[model samples]
Target: MLTYLFMGIALLAIGFAVHVLKWNILIAYYNTKPKEKKNNKNTESYRKILGYYGYITGGIFFLLAFLEFQGISVPPTPVTAVFIVWTMIVMYYAQKDDEDEK
Candidate 1:
């Protein structure tokens, strides 16, 4: 349980570090205008949805971790699965974005 909590915290910390370094692909995608494309509205909506997903996932992990720490036992498998899926999705987007840059 503690390991899962630490892992969740580490993931959130890494995300914050990425934001601080201004290396977040989603943010870049949201702000930069594409030379060939003209639909800013779609990107804007994507950014909003991604932002909400991040907040909601982080909050869920934090809450579950806190509850587990307070003697309320919570299964870690689901949390781990969620984190893994989220990481995979982010990596996919990142690679796709990188390919687009070229």
Candidate 2:
């Protein structure tokens, strides 16, 4: 369980880094497939949402892992609920901002 938690954290961290750095490796790989070009506004919005989600979820998982390691058990139900609510709030604001920009 601990190993899985760590693995998830690592994956989230990598995803966050990839978004922040705009690493071309993944972009190049994705571009290999023929797809219609997306407008800059849509691309930015997608990146913003992805970056926020990765950062928030990664932090939550790290906190849970740390607490578990320290023998402090948190009820999974409440934590999961809070995470969902928080993610919804974030998405709401992100979408709101996009709407305002338009």
Candidate 3:
């Protein structure tokens, strides 16, 4: 029972993060204007890339949760922890890119 509840919550958080990131990307893409006659000039590719990385990271976290829910032994969390940090560093660079463009 508790496992199910925890898994449900983890999945929900992951889903919500992915959904919000994608929505932001779509909204930014559609509602913006060309810069100097180039679509790439002012585009927020950083945010889009972050969205993708976020999806992958969140999915892995949710996978761990699912394994727990299914009564399967989850591997040690070190790899996942490293992956999370890796994603975070990429996200930091993405943010830097966004800032540099501004």
Candidate 4:
């Protein structure tokens, strides 16, 4: 059970990282697009949101890596399951948020 919790947390960290990478790539592509002025409000908003994701995901990855290195684990399966589900839901929302831009 504890192993599962560790594994799930590691997986959650991975999922978050994949998302951050995707968003950064998209942001870079958007920035590099041919445009005369780059001060548009929409571009600024997208950069802000991507910054938020990067900060949050980076922190999560750091914390999880520390926990994994220290071998920390929870005893309850239900809580771990909930965390994994919640992480997935968050990832879905993050991706959905980007869909409107497409």
- Give the number of the best model, judged by TM-score: 2
Tell me the whole-model lDDT of each prediction, alpha carbons only: 0.59, 0.62, 0.55, 0.52
Worst 10 residues of 4 by lDDT: 17-26
TM-score of each: 0.52, 0.64, 0.46, 0.41
lDDT per residue (tens digit) for residues 1-102 in model 1: 566566557656555544443334635554465655434334444444455555556667778878877899877677678778985787477546656755
Write candidate 4's Cα lDDT for 5-101 as tens digits: 4554655454454344444345553566556434444555555555555455445545655675687753446555765686577646544655665
Candidate scoring better on TM-score of 2 and 3? 2
Give me the candidate number with maximum lDDT.
Answer: 2
lDDT of 2 by residue, 2-101 (tens): 7437745864876576578764244332344235533335455546565667776777687788888888887778876877797678667755765576
Model 2 has an lDDT value of 0.62
For model 1, the superposed segments whose C-alpha errors exceed 4 Å read 22-58
3 versus 4: better lDDT goes to: 3
Cα deviation of 64 in candidate 1 (Å)? 1.4
Reference-based TM-score, model 4: 0.41
Error of 1 at 59 (Å): 3.6
The root-mean-square deviation over C-alpha atoms between each candidate and the true structure, in angstroms, is 6.4, 5.1, 6.7, 7.7
lDDT of 4 at 83: 57
lDDT value, candidate 1, whole model: 0.59
